[model samples]
Target: MNPEDLQKLVTMTMPYGKHQGRLLADLPGNYLNWFAREGFPNGELGKLLALMHEIDHNGLSDLLKPLRGRGR
Candidate 1:
């Protein structure tokens, strides 16, 4: 995964859907899991979702903490 992507998770908002406008980093685990089960969307959004899913799945979300503050 690209290091920049970790930062993007904090910076980027969900472009569409029930979570639209929410930060990717803040999406609930259930939401991410739904994507995993249903298949992530295409392009960068999908990749980021997959990455975030992995992070959440393995309990490594704390690794993103240091990057979160930079977004604001």
Candidate 2:
């Protein structure tokens, strides 16, 4: 995905949960891993987080670093 897409994925608020309103990028890796093992939810957000989990696991979070600085 492009940087803008990555930024949106990171900054988007969680629609439901105790951590609702928190950014997707800020969610703990363990939680993401749990979703990975259990199966991700349906919808675009779910797909995005699943992709984020893979990217983060692969040490490519830096790919979004530029967007982070752009304040998106």
Task: Assess each prediction's global lDDT (C-alpha) against the native.
Answer: 0.95, 0.76
Question: How high is the lDDT of residue 23 in model 1?
Answer: 91
TM-score of each: 0.94, 0.78
Q: Which has the greatest lDDT?
A: 1
Candidate with maximal TM-score? 1
lDDT of 1 by residue, 1-72 (tens): 989999999999999999999999899999999999999999999999999999999999999988877946
Residue pairs in clash, model 2:
none
Candidate 2 structure quality by residue, lDDT tens digits, 16-64 = 8767887777766887788899998998788877988987788777776
Model 1, C-alpha of 31: deviation from truth (Å) = 0.6
Write down the TM-score for model 1. Answer: 0.94
Clashes per candidate, residues 3 or more apart or on different chains: 0, 0
